[model samples]
Target: MKNGKSPGSDNIPVEIVKVGRHRVIELLRIAFNKCLEEQTIPEIWNCAIVILLHKKEGTGEKAGSDHVRKTNEWLRHQSKVTDVIKRVARLKWEWVGHMARKTDTWSKRLLEWRPWGEKRPRGRPQMRWDDDIRQIAGTRWLQVAQSRDEWRSLKEAYTQVVETG
Candidate 1:
Protein backbone atom coordinates (compact mmCIF):
# COMPACT_ATOMS: atom_id res chain seq x y z
CA MET A 1 0.00 0.00 0.00
CA LYS A 2 2.91 2.39 0.66
CA ASN A 3 3.99 2.17 -2.99
CA GLY A 4 1.12 2.97 -5.38
CA LYS A 5 2.39 0.80 -8.24
CA SER A 6 1.29 -2.87 -8.55
CA PRO A 7 3.14 -5.43 -10.71
CA GLY A 8 -0.04 -5.70 -12.85
CA SER A 9 -3.86 -6.02 -12.45
CA ASP A 10 -3.67 -9.81 -12.83
CA ASN A 11 -1.23 -10.10 -9.92
CA ILE A 12 -3.89 -10.33 -7.22
CA PRO A 13 -2.36 -11.01 -3.83
CA VAL A 14 -3.29 -14.24 -2.05
CA GLU A 15 -5.39 -13.78 1.07
CA ILE A 16 -3.37 -14.78 4.13
CA VAL A 17 -6.45 -15.70 6.19
CA LYS A 18 -9.94 -17.16 5.66
CA VAL A 19 -12.26 -14.48 4.29
CA GLY A 20 -14.98 -14.59 7.01
CA ARG A 21 -12.54 -14.56 9.91
CA HIS A 22 -10.25 -12.09 8.17
CA ARG A 23 -13.13 -9.63 7.84
CA VAL A 24 -13.99 -10.09 11.53
CA ILE A 25 -10.36 -9.60 12.52
CA GLU A 26 -10.12 -6.49 10.37
CA LEU A 27 -13.34 -5.15 11.93
CA LEU A 28 -11.93 -5.90 15.39
CA ARG A 29 -8.59 -4.30 14.49
CA ILE A 30 -10.35 -1.14 13.35
CA ALA A 31 -12.55 -1.08 16.48
CA PHE A 32 -9.54 -1.48 18.77
CA ASN A 33 -7.60 1.20 16.87
CA LYS A 34 -10.53 3.59 17.04
CA CYS A 35 -11.02 3.03 20.78
CA LEU A 36 -7.34 3.79 21.34
CA GLU A 37 -7.60 6.90 19.19
CA GLU A 38 -10.64 8.18 21.07
CA GLN A 39 -9.82 6.90 24.60
CA THR A 40 -13.32 5.65 25.57
CA ILE A 41 -13.58 2.48 27.64
CA PRO A 42 -17.30 2.49 28.51
CA GLU A 43 -18.30 2.86 24.89
CA ILE A 44 -16.50 -0.41 24.28
CA TRP A 45 -18.01 -1.89 27.44
CA ASN A 46 -21.57 -1.04 26.35
CA CYS A 47 -21.03 -2.71 22.99
CA ALA A 48 -19.88 -5.88 24.73
CA ILE A 49 -22.89 -5.72 27.03
CA VAL A 50 -25.11 -5.51 23.97
CA ILE A 51 -23.34 -8.51 22.42
CA LEU A 52 -23.71 -10.50 25.64
CA LEU A 53 -27.40 -9.70 25.81
CA HIS A 54 -27.81 -10.93 22.25
CA LYS A 55 -25.82 -14.08 22.97
CA LYS A 56 -28.02 -15.07 25.93
CA GLU A 57 -31.74 -14.72 25.27
CA GLY A 58 -34.33 -15.75 27.85
CA THR A 59 -38.17 -16.25 27.99
CA GLY A 60 -39.48 -12.94 26.67
CA GLU A 61 -38.53 -9.31 27.39
CA LYS A 62 -35.38 -10.54 29.17
CA ALA A 63 -33.91 -10.69 25.67
CA GLY A 64 -33.66 -6.92 25.67
CA SER A 65 -32.86 -3.98 28.01
CA ASP A 66 -35.44 -4.58 30.74
CA HIS A 67 -33.75 -7.62 32.18
CA VAL A 68 -30.39 -6.43 30.87
CA ARG A 69 -30.62 -3.27 32.96
CA LYS A 70 -31.61 -5.34 35.98
CA THR A 71 -28.62 -7.59 35.43
CA ASN A 72 -26.32 -4.66 34.76
CA GLU A 73 -27.47 -2.84 37.84
CA TRP A 74 -26.87 -5.87 40.01
CA LEU A 75 -23.52 -6.41 38.31
CA ARG A 76 -22.46 -2.74 38.51
CA HIS A 77 -20.03 -3.47 41.33
CA GLN A 78 -17.52 -4.64 38.74
CA SER A 79 -14.66 -2.48 37.48
CA LYS A 80 -12.96 -4.55 34.74
CA VAL A 81 -14.06 -6.62 31.73
CA THR A 82 -12.53 -9.95 32.81
CA ASP A 83 -14.82 -10.02 35.84
CA VAL A 84 -17.69 -11.27 33.66
CA ILE A 85 -18.15 -14.97 32.88
CA LYS A 86 -16.41 -16.06 29.65
CA ARG A 87 -18.50 -19.09 28.60
CA VAL A 88 -19.45 -17.25 25.41
CA ALA A 89 -16.58 -17.33 22.95
CA ARG A 90 -18.01 -14.30 21.13
CA LEU A 91 -17.60 -12.11 24.22
CA LYS A 92 -14.63 -10.37 22.75
CA TRP A 93 -13.24 -7.38 24.65
CA GLU A 94 -10.61 -6.73 22.00
CA TRP A 95 -13.30 -6.14 19.41
CA VAL A 96 -15.31 -3.97 21.79
CA GLY A 97 -12.15 -2.02 22.68
CA HIS A 98 -11.13 -1.52 19.08
CA MET A 99 -14.49 -0.49 17.67
CA ALA A 100 -16.12 1.41 20.52
CA ARG A 101 -13.70 2.22 23.31
CA LYS A 102 -10.18 2.45 21.79
CA THR A 103 -8.27 0.34 24.36
CA ASP A 104 -7.75 -3.38 24.78
CA THR A 105 -8.71 -4.60 28.25
CA TRP A 106 -6.75 -7.83 28.02
CA SER A 107 -3.88 -6.60 25.88
CA LYS A 108 -1.34 -7.99 28.35
CA ARG A 109 -3.34 -11.19 28.95
CA LEU A 110 -3.66 -11.93 25.21
CA LEU A 111 0.09 -11.57 24.71
CA GLU A 112 0.81 -13.76 27.72
CA TRP A 113 -1.33 -16.79 26.80
CA ARG A 114 -0.03 -19.37 24.33
CA PRO A 115 -2.38 -21.49 22.19
CA TRP A 116 -2.96 -24.52 24.37
CA GLY A 117 -5.97 -26.66 23.47
CA GLU A 118 -9.39 -26.35 25.24
CA LYS A 119 -8.71 -26.61 28.98
CA ARG A 120 -6.81 -23.64 30.36
CA PRO A 121 -6.12 -23.15 34.06
CA ARG A 122 -7.61 -20.04 35.68
CA GLY A 123 -4.49 -18.06 36.54
CA ARG A 124 -1.22 -19.74 35.60
CA PRO A 125 0.29 -18.93 32.21
CA GLN A 126 1.47 -21.91 30.13
CA MET A 127 5.14 -22.56 29.40
CA ARG A 128 6.30 -23.22 25.79
CA TRP A 129 6.60 -26.98 26.43
CA ASP A 130 7.41 -29.02 29.52
CA ASP A 131 10.28 -30.77 27.75
CA ASP A 132 11.16 -31.51 24.12
CA ILE A 133 7.58 -32.51 23.11
CA ARG A 134 7.95 -30.43 19.91
CA GLN A 135 11.18 -32.21 18.92
CA ILE A 136 9.19 -35.12 17.43
CA ALA A 137 5.55 -34.30 16.47
CA GLY A 138 5.81 -35.12 12.74
CA THR A 139 4.13 -38.21 11.21
CA ARG A 140 7.35 -40.14 10.57
CA TRP A 141 8.73 -39.02 13.93
CA LEU A 142 5.59 -40.26 15.78
CA GLN A 143 6.17 -43.84 14.57
CA VAL A 144 9.65 -43.79 16.03
CA ALA A 145 8.29 -42.33 19.27
CA GLN A 146 5.54 -44.98 19.52
CA SER A 147 7.99 -47.82 19.08
CA ARG A 148 10.31 -46.20 21.61
CA ASP A 149 7.59 -46.36 24.31
CA GLU A 150 8.89 -49.01 26.75
CA TRP A 151 5.57 -49.07 28.59
CA ARG A 152 4.02 -50.93 25.66
CA SER A 153 6.29 -53.98 26.11
CA LEU A 154 6.20 -56.46 29.00
CA LYS A 155 9.99 -56.86 28.99
CA GLU A 156 12.04 -55.61 31.95
CA ALA A 157 10.92 -52.06 32.85
CA TYR A 158 14.30 -51.44 34.56
CA THR A 159 16.21 -52.33 31.40
CA GLN A 160 13.98 -50.03 29.23
CA VAL A 161 14.56 -47.02 31.52
CA VAL A 162 18.30 -47.46 31.34
CA GLU A 163 18.22 -47.87 27.56
CA THR A 164 16.09 -44.72 27.16
CA GLY A 165 18.39 -42.79 29.48
Candidate 2:
Protein backbone atom coordinates (compact mmCIF):
# COMPACT_ATOMS: atom_id res chain seq x y z
CA MET A 1 0.00 0.00 0.00
CA LYS A 2 2.84 2.37 0.77
CA ASN A 3 4.48 2.05 -2.68
CA GLY A 4 1.29 3.00 -4.52
CA LYS A 5 0.47 6.52 -5.64
CA SER A 6 -2.59 7.13 -3.47
CA PRO A 7 -2.39 8.56 0.04
CA GLY A 8 -4.90 8.33 2.85
CA SER A 9 -5.48 10.10 6.16
CA ASP A 10 -2.27 8.73 7.68
CA ASN A 11 -0.34 10.23 4.71
CA ILE A 12 1.43 6.93 4.21
CA PRO A 13 1.80 6.27 0.50
CA VAL A 14 0.32 3.10 -0.96
CA GLU A 15 3.82 1.88 -1.78
CA ILE A 16 4.60 1.82 1.93
CA VAL A 17 1.29 0.27 2.83
CA LYS A 18 1.70 -2.57 0.27
CA VAL A 19 4.97 -3.67 1.85
CA GLY A 20 3.15 -6.02 4.25
CA ARG A 21 -0.40 -7.02 3.45
CA HIS A 22 -0.74 -9.12 6.59
CA ARG A 23 0.33 -6.28 8.81
CA VAL A 24 -2.01 -3.90 7.05
CA ILE A 25 -4.94 -6.32 7.34
CA GLU A 26 -4.26 -6.92 11.02
CA LEU A 27 -3.96 -3.22 11.73
CA LEU A 28 -7.15 -2.41 9.82
CA ARG A 29 -9.04 -5.27 11.43
CA ILE A 30 -8.04 -4.07 14.87
CA ALA A 31 -8.95 -0.45 14.13
CA PHE A 32 -12.25 -1.27 12.43
CA ASN A 33 -13.17 -3.84 15.07
CA LYS A 34 -12.57 -1.24 17.76
CA CYS A 35 -14.91 1.13 15.97
CA LEU A 36 -17.50 -1.64 15.59
CA GLU A 37 -17.18 -2.51 19.27
CA GLU A 38 -17.74 1.11 20.16
CA GLN A 39 -20.69 1.41 17.71
CA THR A 40 -19.25 4.52 16.07
CA ILE A 41 -16.80 5.07 13.24
CA PRO A 42 -14.46 8.04 13.54
CA GLU A 43 -15.49 11.44 12.18
CA ILE A 44 -12.62 11.58 9.69
CA TRP A 45 -14.20 8.91 7.46
CA ASN A 46 -17.50 10.73 7.10
CA CYS A 47 -16.72 12.84 4.08
CA ALA A 48 -17.15 12.78 0.30
CA ILE A 49 -16.41 14.96 -2.69
CA VAL A 50 -18.88 15.80 -5.44
CA ILE A 51 -17.72 16.88 -8.88
CA LEU A 52 -20.11 18.03 -11.59
CA LEU A 53 -19.22 17.84 -15.23
CA HIS A 54 -20.26 20.48 -17.70
CA LYS A 55 -22.72 18.55 -19.82
CA LYS A 56 -23.05 19.31 -23.50
CA GLU A 57 -26.02 19.14 -25.86
CA GLY A 58 -26.27 17.04 -29.03
CA THR A 59 -24.68 19.84 -31.05
CA GLY A 60 -21.68 19.92 -28.65
CA GLU A 61 -22.67 23.24 -27.11
CA LYS A 62 -22.65 23.54 -23.31
CA ALA A 63 -26.10 22.81 -22.00
CA GLY A 64 -27.95 25.04 -19.57
CA SER A 65 -29.42 23.66 -16.36
CA ASP A 66 -32.72 22.84 -18.05
CA HIS A 67 -31.04 20.97 -20.90
CA VAL A 68 -28.78 19.18 -18.44
CA ARG A 69 -31.82 18.13 -16.44
CA LYS A 70 -33.47 16.77 -19.57
CA THR A 71 -30.32 14.89 -20.51
CA ASN A 72 -30.05 13.43 -17.02
CA GLU A 73 -33.67 12.37 -17.19
CA TRP A 74 -33.07 10.57 -20.45
CA LEU A 75 -29.91 8.94 -19.17
CA ARG A 76 -31.66 7.84 -16.01
CA HIS A 77 -34.55 6.46 -18.00
CA GLN A 78 -32.12 4.38 -20.04
CA SER A 79 -29.64 3.11 -17.47
CA LYS A 80 -28.51 2.52 -13.84
CA VAL A 81 -27.30 5.94 -12.71
CA THR A 82 -30.22 6.14 -10.31
CA ASP A 83 -29.20 2.91 -8.61
CA VAL A 84 -25.57 3.97 -8.41
CA ILE A 85 -26.54 7.29 -6.86
CA LYS A 86 -28.71 5.49 -4.34
CA ARG A 87 -25.78 3.29 -3.30
CA VAL A 88 -23.55 6.32 -2.83
CA ALA A 89 -26.28 8.07 -0.89
CA ARG A 90 -26.74 4.99 1.29
CA LEU A 91 -23.05 5.10 2.17
CA LYS A 92 -23.33 8.78 2.94
CA TRP A 93 -26.31 8.15 5.24
CA GLU A 94 -24.25 5.58 7.12
CA TRP A 95 -21.80 8.36 8.04
CA VAL A 96 -24.29 11.01 9.12
CA GLY A 97 -25.04 9.29 12.41
CA HIS A 98 -21.39 9.06 13.33
CA MET A 99 -20.79 12.67 12.31
CA ALA A 100 -23.79 13.89 14.29
CA ARG A 101 -22.30 12.44 17.47
CA LYS A 102 -18.95 14.26 17.11
CA THR A 103 -18.50 17.60 18.94
CA ASP A 104 -14.77 18.25 19.07
CA THR A 105 -14.77 20.91 16.33
CA TRP A 106 -16.54 24.21 15.67
CA SER A 107 -17.49 23.33 12.11
CA LYS A 108 -19.04 20.04 13.12
CA ARG A 109 -20.87 21.77 15.94
CA LEU A 110 -22.23 24.41 13.58
CA LEU A 111 -23.50 21.78 11.16
CA GLU A 112 -25.07 19.55 13.78
CA TRP A 113 -26.31 22.22 16.17
CA ARG A 114 -27.62 24.66 13.51
CA PRO A 115 -27.71 27.66 15.80
CA TRP A 116 -30.16 30.54 15.26
CA GLY A 117 -29.85 34.09 13.78
CA GLU A 118 -28.66 33.07 10.33
CA LYS A 119 -30.82 34.43 7.56
CA ARG A 120 -30.96 33.40 3.93
CA PRO A 121 -31.58 35.46 0.81
CA ARG A 122 -35.10 35.77 -0.57
CA GLY A 123 -34.60 32.95 -3.05
CA ARG A 124 -33.90 29.26 -2.49
CA PRO A 125 -32.81 28.24 0.99
CA GLN A 126 -29.35 26.79 1.20
CA MET A 127 -29.36 23.04 1.62
CA ARG A 128 -27.86 21.94 4.92
CA TRP A 129 -26.36 18.52 5.51
CA ASP A 130 -28.98 17.82 8.12
CA ASP A 131 -31.68 18.69 5.64
CA ASP A 132 -30.39 16.14 3.16
CA ILE A 133 -30.25 13.48 5.86
CA ARG A 134 -33.74 14.29 6.97
CA GLN A 135 -35.07 14.08 3.43
CA ILE A 136 -33.58 10.59 3.11
CA ALA A 137 -33.97 9.20 6.62
CA GLY A 138 -36.91 11.17 7.97
CA THR A 139 -37.37 13.52 10.95
CA ARG A 140 -36.48 10.88 13.54
CA TRP A 141 -33.09 9.93 12.17
CA LEU A 142 -31.24 11.05 15.29
CA GLN A 143 -33.49 8.88 17.37
CA VAL A 144 -33.08 6.00 14.93
CA ALA A 145 -29.31 6.29 15.10
CA GLN A 146 -29.39 5.68 18.83
CA SER A 147 -29.78 2.01 17.98
CA ARG A 148 -26.79 1.25 15.80
CA ASP A 149 -28.12 -2.04 14.51
CA GLU A 150 -31.37 -0.59 13.28
CA TRP A 151 -29.66 2.41 11.74
CA ARG A 152 -27.28 0.26 9.72
CA SER A 153 -30.00 -2.08 8.56
CA LEU A 154 -32.28 0.70 7.36
CA LYS A 155 -29.68 2.86 5.63
CA GLU A 156 -29.79 1.01 2.30
CA ALA A 157 -33.54 0.76 2.02
CA TYR A 158 -34.17 4.33 3.17
CA THR A 159 -31.73 5.92 0.77
CA GLN A 160 -33.25 3.92 -2.07
CA VAL A 161 -36.64 5.30 -1.14
CA VAL A 162 -35.33 8.86 -1.14
CA GLU A 163 -33.56 8.41 -4.44
CA THR A 164 -36.39 6.74 -6.34
CA GLY A 165 -39.09 9.04 -5.06
Candidate 3:
Protein backbone atom coordinates (compact mmCIF):
# COMPACT_ATOMS: atom_id res chain seq x y z
CA MET A 1 0.00 0.00 0.00
CA LYS A 2 3.00 2.24 0.37
CA ASN A 3 4.05 4.45 -2.54
CA GLY A 4 7.49 4.27 -4.22
CA LYS A 5 7.80 0.55 -3.41
CA SER A 6 8.33 -1.98 -6.17
CA PRO A 7 5.16 -3.36 -7.76
CA GLY A 8 4.11 -6.93 -6.96
CA SER A 9 3.92 -9.75 -9.51
CA ASP A 10 0.77 -8.15 -10.91
CA ASN A 11 2.96 -5.23 -12.05
CA ILE A 12 0.43 -2.69 -10.81
CA PRO A 13 2.13 0.27 -9.15
CA VAL A 14 0.68 1.88 -6.02
CA GLU A 15 0.51 5.19 -7.87
CA ILE A 16 -1.95 3.67 -10.32
CA VAL A 17 -4.05 2.39 -7.46
CA LYS A 18 -3.95 5.77 -5.79
CA VAL A 19 -5.11 7.45 -8.98
CA GLY A 20 -8.16 5.17 -9.14
CA ARG A 21 -8.62 4.84 -5.41
CA HIS A 22 -12.40 4.44 -5.23
CA ARG A 23 -12.66 2.01 -8.14
CA VAL A 24 -9.63 0.03 -6.91
CA ILE A 25 -11.02 -0.19 -3.38
CA GLU A 26 -14.43 -1.37 -4.64
CA LEU A 27 -12.85 -3.95 -6.95
CA LEU A 28 -10.55 -5.19 -4.20
CA ARG A 29 -13.47 -5.42 -1.77
CA ILE A 30 -15.51 -7.53 -4.18
CA ALA A 31 -12.52 -9.72 -5.00
CA PHE A 32 -11.76 -10.27 -1.31
CA ASN A 33 -15.41 -11.16 -0.59
CA LYS A 34 -15.51 -13.60 -3.51
CA CYS A 35 -12.24 -15.18 -2.40
CA LEU A 36 -13.55 -15.59 1.15
CA GLU A 37 -16.85 -17.08 -0.05
CA GLU A 38 -15.07 -19.52 -2.36
CA GLN A 39 -12.22 -20.24 0.04
CA THR A 40 -9.78 -19.68 -2.77
CA ILE A 41 -7.28 -16.95 -3.62
CA PRO A 42 -6.01 -15.90 -7.04
CA GLU A 43 -2.79 -17.66 -7.97
CA ILE A 44 -1.11 -14.42 -8.98
CA TRP A 45 -1.57 -13.10 -5.43
CA ASN A 46 0.91 -15.73 -4.20
CA CYS A 47 3.66 -14.61 -6.54
CA ALA A 48 6.31 -12.03 -5.72
CA ILE A 49 9.16 -10.35 -7.61
CA VAL A 50 12.44 -9.78 -5.90
CA ILE A 51 14.86 -7.36 -7.50
CA LEU A 52 18.23 -6.46 -6.07
CA LEU A 53 19.89 -3.32 -7.30
CA HIS A 54 23.62 -3.18 -7.71
CA LYS A 55 25.56 -0.84 -5.43
CA LYS A 56 27.22 2.26 -6.92
CA GLU A 57 30.69 0.74 -6.89
CA GLY A 58 29.40 -2.52 -8.33
CA THR A 59 27.59 -0.73 -11.13
CA GLY A 60 30.62 1.32 -12.22
CA GLU A 61 32.76 -1.75 -12.85
CA LYS A 62 32.76 -3.18 -16.40
CA ALA A 63 30.98 -6.53 -16.77
CA GLY A 64 33.73 -8.24 -18.83
CA SER A 65 36.84 -6.33 -17.64
CA ASP A 66 39.97 -7.86 -16.10
CA HIS A 67 38.83 -6.73 -12.65
CA VAL A 68 37.26 -9.34 -10.40
CA ARG A 69 33.49 -9.40 -10.15
CA LYS A 70 32.24 -8.37 -6.72
CA THR A 71 30.33 -11.00 -4.85
CA ASN A 72 26.91 -10.31 -3.37
CA GLU A 73 28.39 -10.28 0.14
CA TRP A 74 31.10 -7.79 -0.89
CA LEU A 75 28.55 -5.56 -2.63
CA ARG A 76 26.28 -5.70 0.44
CA HIS A 77 29.23 -4.74 2.62
CA GLN A 78 29.89 -1.69 0.47
CA SER A 79 26.20 -0.70 0.14
CA LYS A 80 24.24 1.43 2.62
CA VAL A 81 21.33 -1.01 2.76
CA THR A 82 20.64 -2.22 6.29
CA ASP A 83 20.51 -5.95 7.03
CA VAL A 84 16.87 -7.00 7.71
CA ILE A 85 17.80 -9.62 10.33
CA LYS A 86 20.12 -7.23 12.18
CA ARG A 87 17.41 -4.55 12.24
CA VAL A 88 14.81 -7.06 13.48
CA ALA A 89 17.15 -8.40 16.19
CA ARG A 90 17.97 -4.86 17.36
CA LEU A 91 14.26 -3.96 17.48
CA LYS A 92 13.42 -7.20 19.32
CA TRP A 93 16.16 -6.55 21.91
CA GLU A 94 14.87 -3.01 22.48
CA TRP A 95 11.26 -4.25 22.81
CA VAL A 96 12.27 -6.98 25.29
CA GLY A 97 14.21 -4.43 27.34
CA HIS A 98 11.23 -2.07 27.31
CA MET A 99 8.82 -4.84 28.31
CA ALA A 100 11.16 -6.00 31.09
CA ARG A 101 11.01 -2.52 32.67
CA LYS A 102 7.21 -2.53 32.88
CA THR A 103 5.70 -3.45 36.27
CA ASP A 104 2.35 -5.17 35.57
CA THR A 105 1.52 -4.97 31.86
CA TRP A 106 0.04 -7.84 29.85
CA SER A 107 2.93 -7.49 27.40
CA LYS A 108 5.47 -8.06 30.13
CA ARG A 109 3.49 -10.97 31.58
CA LEU A 110 3.17 -12.64 28.18
CA LEU A 111 6.85 -12.02 27.49
CA GLU A 112 7.86 -13.90 30.64
CA TRP A 113 5.22 -16.64 30.28
CA ARG A 114 6.29 -20.23 29.43
CA PRO A 115 4.18 -23.07 28.02
CA TRP A 116 3.25 -25.74 30.57
CA GLY A 117 3.18 -29.07 28.72
CA GLU A 118 5.95 -29.10 26.19
CA LYS A 119 8.23 -32.16 25.85
CA ARG A 120 11.61 -32.24 24.18
CA PRO A 121 11.56 -33.53 20.58
CA ARG A 122 14.81 -32.03 19.32
CA GLY A 123 18.56 -32.57 19.66
CA ARG A 124 19.08 -29.09 21.12
CA PRO A 125 16.77 -26.55 22.76
CA GLN A 126 15.59 -23.86 20.38
CA MET A 127 16.98 -20.34 20.78
CA ARG A 128 14.81 -18.06 22.90
CA TRP A 129 13.87 -14.36 22.61
CA ASP A 130 16.06 -13.40 25.55
CA ASP A 131 18.98 -15.68 24.65
CA ASP A 132 20.91 -12.92 22.89
CA ILE A 133 20.16 -10.49 25.70
CA ARG A 134 21.34 -13.02 28.28
CA GLN A 135 24.52 -13.59 26.29
CA ILE A 136 25.27 -9.85 26.29
CA ALA A 137 23.90 -8.71 29.67
CA GLY A 138 24.28 -11.93 31.68
CA THR A 139 21.44 -13.81 33.44
CA ARG A 140 20.22 -10.61 35.17
CA TRP A 141 19.20 -8.87 31.96
CA LEU A 142 15.72 -8.08 33.24
CA GLN A 143 17.14 -6.53 36.38
CA VAL A 144 19.65 -4.59 34.27
CA ALA A 145 16.81 -3.41 32.01
CA GLN A 146 14.87 -2.01 34.99
CA SER A 147 17.17 0.99 35.33
CA ARG A 148 16.65 3.56 32.55
CA ASP A 149 20.28 4.67 32.35
CA GLU A 150 21.59 1.09 32.47
CA TRP A 151 19.09 -0.09 29.88
CA ARG A 152 20.04 2.79 27.54
CA SER A 153 23.71 1.85 27.78
CA LEU A 154 22.88 -1.79 27.20
CA LYS A 155 20.79 -0.87 24.12
CA GLU A 156 23.67 1.15 22.69
CA ALA A 157 26.05 -1.75 23.23
CA TYR A 158 23.54 -4.11 21.63
CA THR A 159 23.13 -1.81 18.60
CA GLN A 160 26.89 -1.56 18.09
CA VAL A 161 27.29 -5.31 18.33
CA VAL A 162 24.45 -5.98 15.87
CA GLU A 163 25.71 -3.40 13.36
CA THR A 164 29.25 -4.75 13.40
CA GLY A 165 28.43 -8.43 13.52
**Best model number under lDDT:** 3
lDDT of 2: 0.64
Candidate 1 lDDT over 1-165, as tens digits, reads: 223344333353333233355565666556655655465554435543222434344535644443333454243333222222231111232232233222344753553346767777698766542122222223232233334342123123322332343
Q: Assess candidate 3 and give its TM-score to the true structure.
A: 0.49
Which wins on TM-score, candidate 1 or candidate 2? 2
Question: Which regions in candidate 2 have their CA more than 4 angstroms from the true location?
Answer: 1-83, 103-108
Tell me which residue pairs clash in candidate 3: none
The best candidate in terms of TM-score = 3
Which candidate model has the greater TM-score, 1 or 3?
3
RMSD in order of candidates: 22.8, 13.7, 10.9
The sequence of per-residue lDDT tens digits that candidate 2 reaches over residues 1-165 is 124466755677776666776677667766765664465778877774445766445543355333434566574454322345565677677677676555577744664575579876798888765676676557887776767887788787777666775
Q: What is the C-alpha local distance difference test score of each model?
A: 0.36, 0.64, 0.72
TM-scores of the candidates are 0.18, 0.41, 0.49
Better of 1 and 2 by lDDT: 2
